[model samples]
Target: MYMKLKCFICGYEVYGDPLTNTQCPRCRGILAVHYTNPVFKIDSRGKGVWRYSSLLPDVGERISLGEGLTPINNVGEIYVKNERFNPTGSYADRSSAIITSVLKVRNIDTFTILYEEDFTKSLTHYTHFVGLKPSISIPRIDLVDLDDILFFISRGIDIVFDNKPLNTLVIKYLNPLTVEGLKTIAFENYESRIPVERVVVPCETGLLALSILKGFKELKERNVDVDYEVVAVSIKNRGCQLLNNVREVKVVEVGDREVFEALREAYEKGFKTKPLSALSLYIAENIGKSLAVVTMGFKTVTSRESAVKKLILEILSQGKPMTAYEIWKTKPIYTLRAVYKAIKDMENKKEICFEIVSKGRRKIKVYRLC
Candidate 1:
C-alpha cells in the first residue's frame, strides 16, 4: 500500500504521497515509485496491462480504457510494436490510466496538465472519462489543432497561458505513476516470446525509453535473462537529460525527410501512425532483430462525436437556434460528417428538433434543444 518514491539520480527516498511529491526535494531529480516485495506474474485471465498487476501498485480501483496488448507486426526483419491501437489511439493512454487510478484512489477530483504534443490529447481524453477536471497549461493556444482545442473546451477543461506553478496534481512524464504504467509495454514485449536483439523507441522526454529499460531491469531482477539493447531515436541533436549517461543506450537523430519516408512506408503498410512512431521504425530499419514501438496514430475525422454532440446540445440549450455550420464553426471539434451524424442521432432520439429556414436564396437546417 505504501510505495516509496525514490529519486532516480540520488537514490533519496520519500515515504509520503507520490502524487504530490513528484520531484526529489534534495536533488531535484524525478522520483520513481519503488514497491516493496515486487513480484512479476502474468494473470492469464486479465485483460490489457492489468495482467501484470502483481508487479504494479494496488492503487484502489483500476482505471483502464483497454490500453496495451498492441499487435507485434513483422516488417521485413524488424518487429514493430504498434501502440497506436490503444483506446485513445496513443501509448500515453497506458500512463494516463495508471495516473488517473492513483488520483482517484487518493480522492483527488481535479488536476492540472502541462500540455505536450500527442500525450496531452491522450491525457485529456482519459481525464475527461474519469470525471477529473483538467486545467491545461500551454505556451500558445494556436499551436494546438482546432479539433483538440474544441474538444477540450467542450469538456469544460480550463486552458491557461500563464507559467505560474500550481500545487494541484500536474500530469507530466516525470510522474512515477506514468512511468510505472509504461513499463507494461516492455512486459508485453518480453511475454511475446520473440527474440529481441534490440528495441527502437522515439525519445521525447526520455520517459518511455527509461520506463522500458526499467521494465527489462525488473525482469532481469527476477532472474529472467534479457540481452536486448535499447535504441532511442530523437528528432534533435541534444536529447533528453534523463537518458544522458544511461548505458547500452544509443541515441540517434533523424532528419524530417527520414521521418516522412518512414511515415509513408508505415502508412503504405497499413499502419497510420504519428511521425514520432515513424522515427522509431526508421531507426529499426538498420538494426537486426529490432522491435520498433509506434506510439500514436492520426486522429480520425469522426472520433470525437460524443463530445461534439454534447457541445451541440449545450449550445442549443441556450435558447438560440443555430445552423450546423454555425455549430461547426463554434465548436470545430467534430468534422462536418461527424456533426451531422450526431445531429441525426439526437433528432431520432427526440432530444432535439431541427427546422429548415430560408435566408436570401439559401435554405439551411437549424437545430434547437427540445
Candidate 2:
C-alpha cells in the first residue's frame, strides 16, 4: 500500500496502490488522491513541483520544474495562486508533469495529446524537461499549415489530441497529474493564511475543484485550522452544464447567446474558457431547468451582456432564431438600435418570431426558438 484514496462523495477510504484502482465502491464517486504518509516532507530546495514529491504518486525519476511555491495574491474576496506563474505556465502543467512522470516510471511508454493548443505546448515542454518525448495531435494541425507545431509532432512528440475525447479514460489518464499538482496550492494556502472562506476556481472539467477539495481534506486531517467552501464556476455550455448538473454542483448560467461569445472572446484573447459548459448553461436556462444550489446562500457571477450576445450568436449561427439583440441598458459595442435593427431584419425574413409584449409604457421584444 503506497497511496490511499478516498471517495469525494461518501468519504470512503481505500488503502492500496493507486495505479490500478479507479473508483470508490461506497458511493461510486471518483476516488480522490490521498498520500499514505500524512507528515511527508520534501526538499523545498529542489526545482519544480517535484519539491513536494513526497505527497505525489510513487514514481521513478520524477519530472519537475521550478513548479511549486506559486505566489498567492488576494483579489477582493478571492485569493488567487497566480498559477500563470508555473514554468510551462497555467496550472495544467503541474498535473501533466505528474501524470507523465508516473506513467513513465510504470514503463507505460504513454504519449500525451491535449485538445487545447497552449496546453499541448505546456505538456510537451514539461515532459521533455522530465526526459519523456510528448506529441500533440492538433485538430486543425492540417487545416492550418503550422510552422513549428508541425515539425514538433512529426518528430516523435509524446502526446497531442485536439478533438475532444469521447472516451472518459483518455481524459482521466491525461489529467491525473493536474489534480495532484493543484493539491499543492491548497497545501501552501493552508500553511500561509487562514483557510479561505471560499474558493472560486475556473473549472473546465471540475478536476481543479476536485483537487482543491482533496487538498483541503488533507489539511483538515492534519489538524490545520482551515475552513472554506469550494465553488466550481461553470459556463452556460452543453457538456459541462450536464455533468455539473448531474454531479449536483451549483451551475450558474449567465448571458444569453453571449455565453458562446464570451468563450470565443476568451479563446481569441488567449484566455481559458470551456464552451461545452457555457452551451449547457444556455440550454438549461432557456428550458427553465437548473441544478440545485449547493449552499443555502451563495453569489453567482456572470456578464449578462456577454451571455446574451453568445445566446444570440448561437441562435443566428444555427439559423434557428433568425436574429437577436440587447434591449437592456448596458455597455458593449452593440447599441440598442443595432440590436433592434438586426431583430427587425431577421423577423422580416421569418428567421425568428418577433413579439413585443407591453410592460406598462415600455415594450420588450421576445425571440422564441424556431
Candidate 3:
C-alpha cells in the first residue's frame, strides 16, 4: 500500500494518490510529504543539500549544483550567512535547480519563470546550469535603462513585463521540490555549533520566508532546539504587502518618497520621527513584527558610473529629464568624482546602467532606472 500523505498546513489526511493533489484542499497551502516517523537521523555520507533529502519529497531525478555548505560569517552581533557564495551568487540557485529538475522529469520544457528584478540573473544562471529554458519577467520600472536591457539580453534572458504569469503560478513557482531545497539552509543551521538567534532573509516575494518556516518546523520535529525569530526584510517601496496579510501580522507599509521626504525634512528642521510617515510606520510595524530595522546606504548614481538609474528616478519622479549639470546643481554631494567612480564599479558588476543625451551645445547625461 502507498504511504499516507497529509497537508502541511491543515494536517488533512490525504487518502488518494499523492500525485493527484499537490496542495491542500482546505487551506490551499502547499502539501508536504508525510512519513511514518516525523523525525529520523541520517548518516552524513551525502554532501551538500542532499543530506537533508530524507525530510523532503523524492524527486525522480535530482539536478544539483553543489548548493550546500555556504560559509557562514560572523558580522558584528549577527551571523551573516553569505548566500552570495552559492553556485549562482544568489540563494535562488538551490531552489531553481530543484524546480528545474522536477520540470525536466515532468517533460515540461518551455515554462516561464516570472521573478522580480533581483532574481533574474540567479534564475538565468540556474536554468542554464540545469540545461532548461525559461522566459523571465520583471517590472518595466525595475528595468530602468537601455543598458540594463542590454545586460539581460546579453545573458540570454527573455524579458517580459507582466504580473499575469506570477499570479497564475502563485506559490507553485516554489514547488515542493523548491521548498525542499530551502530546507538545506535550515539543516546547515541545525548542524552549526552556535545556532542562529534570528534568520534574516531578503524578501522580494514571501517564498523564502515560507520555506524558512517549514524548514524550522522540520528542525523542531528533529529535536533541534532551534529557537529563532524569522525576519523578512524588504525595500520600503518594492516590498510585497501580501506577506503581512499571509502571516496574519499587523504590518506597516512605507514608501521611498516618504522616507526621502522625512530625511530632507529632518535635515532642514530637526531629526525626529514625528514628521516622517514612513519612519513612524516602520517603527511601529517593526515593533509589531519583532523585526530589526537595518538601513542600507545607497551609493550615489553619478554620470561617470550609472547616469541611467539617477535619470530614471528623476523621470519617474516628474516625467522630466535632468542634465548632469542640473543634477549636480541640485544634488552637489552626489556629483562627486568618487561617487561617479563607485557607480562605474557597480555598473561593471551588472548592478546598474548609465546613458548620455546630447542637447544643443551642452550634452546632458541622464541616469535611468533599474
Using TM-score as the measure, the top candidate is 1
Q: Tens-digit lDDT track for model 2 on 178-248?
A: 56877776666665664345555555556566776677776777666677665565544632321342343
Number of clashes in every candidate structure?
0, 49, 10
Query: Comparing candidate 1 with candidate 3, which one achieves the higher TM-score?
Result: 1
The candidate maximizing lDDT is 1
Every model's TM-score: 0.75, 0.56, 0.56
Task: Show model 3 residue runs off by greater than 4 Å.
Answer: 1-47, 137-152, 155-174, 234-370
RMSD of 2: 12.9
Note the residue pairs that clash in candidate 1.
none
RMSD of each: 14.3, 12.9, 13.4
Give the distance in Å from residue 270's predicted Cα in candidate 2 to where it truly belongs.
Answer: 14
lDDT of every predicted structure (CA atoms): 0.78, 0.53, 0.53
lDDT, candidate 3, equals 0.53
Residue 152, model 3: Cα distance from true site in angstroms: 4.7
